[model samples]
Target: MIALDIAIKNKYYANSTAVVLKDIQFSVKPGEFVAIIGPSGSGKTTLLNMLSGLEDATAQKLLGNSKSLHDCKEYQLGYVFQQPRLMPWLTVNENIQLVLPTAQERKIKTLLAQVGLADKGDYYPKQLSGGMQRRVAIARAFAVNPELILLDEPFNSLDAPTAAKLRLLLVNLCKSCGSTVVFVTHDLSEAIYLADRIIFMSNSPSSIIHQVNVNLPKPRKESGSTELAWQSQLMAQYPQILSGSVSTD
Candidate 1:
């Protein structure tokens, strides 16, 4: 289990009076996929940073089981950014090797195959298309075999078709790894499709405004009628969420 109750203070300010995230609270069960969505500048990335131990929080109390965030030495983390962020100098296989330096060559090849890039492993980052580079990044993230994965709108920049394909790949990878995921996305439909629970946030000085349990069955299809119906019902019930007005203190 992962639990967080923290507030992030602006590091640039001397007084530290500015708080970007205001006492945000939530928990993620093991093997659960949670999506965080909010308006622009709502501190979604800041929250992810805090969770990943990249930033410090004031009066924070984050616990992963019996270990606190500061001392959770056993936890393994993986991150996929909006951009692919691959090393241009490395081949597709070598980029993955950068993470799992000792992983077997056969295992690396299998990962490439899983991401639909089996034949492209020998290609350099510049040789691949934008979407393909992102696929390589995804493959590298999973290669770490992290216990928790953080995604910051990895598909936001892709066209609809490409993004949909990556989403499917992500779902399959998560299921196979049983890794707990905290995905931050601006797209409501994507969140609805991927998250086991959606944690909605307020604007800057953000806090948890509400949490919506998806309650959908496993192996969700993006275009299936069930997904469409759920999306319609969710939007109908909380139209403000789609419009970035769900914040209520």
Candidate 2:
């Protein structure tokens, strides 16, 4: 069975004649990591929001192994936003526990350790570095061992070294838990590194313009030869892919 089936017919702000998303449809397989890449302002975050149930998904015709985000009573979803969005007043450990009051301290401890923040649990968000805050956010998302995880540029704005470490950590955790992931990003190289398949979205009134499978070995190294070669090949084949200038036709 598919992990998710989404057919978003259209999205428009109230009383606005301009359209944001149109005829955007795709399906994610169980345990597959899919990345949706597009230029900024292409509604990638909006789509993630709809999937998370933070925004209404009435227009999102989601099905198969799941229902609309609001009525998806059986699907356990996790999300890591562009910002860590941690509760400033809450300690890192407490932020995780807040999401799952029933979660044991031991379980939370293990998660923090997995994200490489074992000792920082007692520290509040204000006391942690940006990267540290993100670690807590990720730990909180994984606390429930979600069936599907949605990540919105989770590594955005981090230093290259830090982002690379987190990417490896995120992928390793996803592999261990076997969670299907849908990550949205504007970075083609990042998409190539993390995704099993990458879907390119067109400019506004967006729809998927292209989809390419990455046959590279899993847990790829940053700027690895094979990874770089594959990326180069894709770029050569479709120079306009990243800029959202590729034709949806």
Candidate 3:
């Protein structure tokens, strides 16, 4: 459903130029969920922005449904940022409804309920916890019934337990809707649990160093037998972490 041939070069710092991304080539099949994990400043967000068509592709081209990014008619993109980015003045239901572009009240209620916010639709952003607000953000994204969703650290603010639960909920929701998801995170365990394939990038001026298929079954567990093996693999792939003691699960 999505294809990218990206080559990004920028001088964010001094006179030295940095090749943030280099001829990065990848494709996402319809209804597939792919996770991108990398060290900080590894251009993961940059890649996501390009894929979402929010940022101008520097030296790359994206084709979806065999059509260029500009020509693809089926392209409906939704984004979930690290922050919930909810409007404080709006109720949770209203927040989600803002994106629906529909007068269907039933649609808003159904979406709020889908994200486990049925009872909280009347509440405002300030009245809810961080996780709840994020849920509202998610409902807003999925409420649009997007063909492609770009999630950039969607669970960054939540506690471990909350984050883990939301991760699974998101996976199931996407699967049921047949939405293609490109999730970006620095969390290895989150990636392993939620992704069909995990792409790892090295440090700054980074490129895809490893792409491992998560052979585990769907609805992954936090304490699974293969968890340790995946952790070991990521640790080995990580450059600065020489200890190889990083645990993912």
Candidate 4:
């Protein structure tokens, strides 16, 4: 269980204080997948940071398993950033292995297979396509077996088809592993496709404008009426979400 009662009293600027995120409150159950989406400059990444205990909340509680976030164990988190952020010099297998606890080569091979990179493990980051690099990044994150995973637009650079396939793989893996996912993305369709619930936020000085609980059945079909309907519903709220803001603390 992860909960964040987030409120930002004030924020820093070049010469003064400004507010970024305010009155942001949400609770995520174990094994639930929640996606946060907003325009650029919104507090999406900042929000993730607070939830992961990389930043402090001005006047709210951040809890992991009902305790303070900072007090929680570090191993509970598995983060995948927007960029692959992999070392160019490291082979795909080496990169994933670097984050894994074991020295077993089979573990690397297994993760590569899971991310659809089994044949590309020996290739370096520079040798892979953008989507492939991201796959390697995902493989690294999953290798940790974290209970709570945070993803920040990890598939943004991929084509729609590839992205959709990866999303399916990711959601299925999360379900099978019983991992709770807090993913940040700008893609509404992707959110509708993979999330159990979608949290829509306004631009900077952000807060939740709407929460659309995805009612689509599991193993979400890429092309189907149910998924399309939910996607349309979330998209309909985009304009309102972009134009509003909420006070934090």
Which candidate leads the pack in TM-score? 2
> Please, what is the TM-score per model?
0.90, 0.95, 0.86, 0.87
Residues 188-241, candidate 3: write the lDDT tens digits.
778888888877776766666667788887767875768767777657665443
Model 4, span 28-71: residue lDDT tens: 87778999888788878877877776666545667677777767
lDDT of each: 0.82, 0.86, 0.75, 0.77
Q: Which residue pairs clash within candidate 2?
A: none
- Residue 142 displacement in candidate 2 (angstroms): 0.4
The TM-score-based order of candidates, best leading, equals 2, 1, 4, 3
Runs with alpha carbons beyond 4 Å of true place in candidate 1: 1-16, 247-249
Name the best candidate (by lDDT): 2
Which of 3 and 4 is ahead in TM-score?
A: 4
Q: In model 1, which residue pairs have backbone atoms overlapping below 3 Å?
A: none
Please tell me which model should have the higher lDDT, number 1 or number 2: 2
Q: Kindly give the stretch of ten consecutive residues in candidate 1 with the minimal lDDT sum.
A: 5-14
Residue 136 in candidate 1, Cα distance off native in Å:
0.8
lDDT of 2 by residue, 72-121 (tens): 46667789999999998899888999888496899999999999998988
lDDT ranking from best candidate downward: 2, 1, 4, 3
Residue range 57-117, candidate 1, lDDT tens digits: 5457776764676676766778988789999999998899988858679888988999999
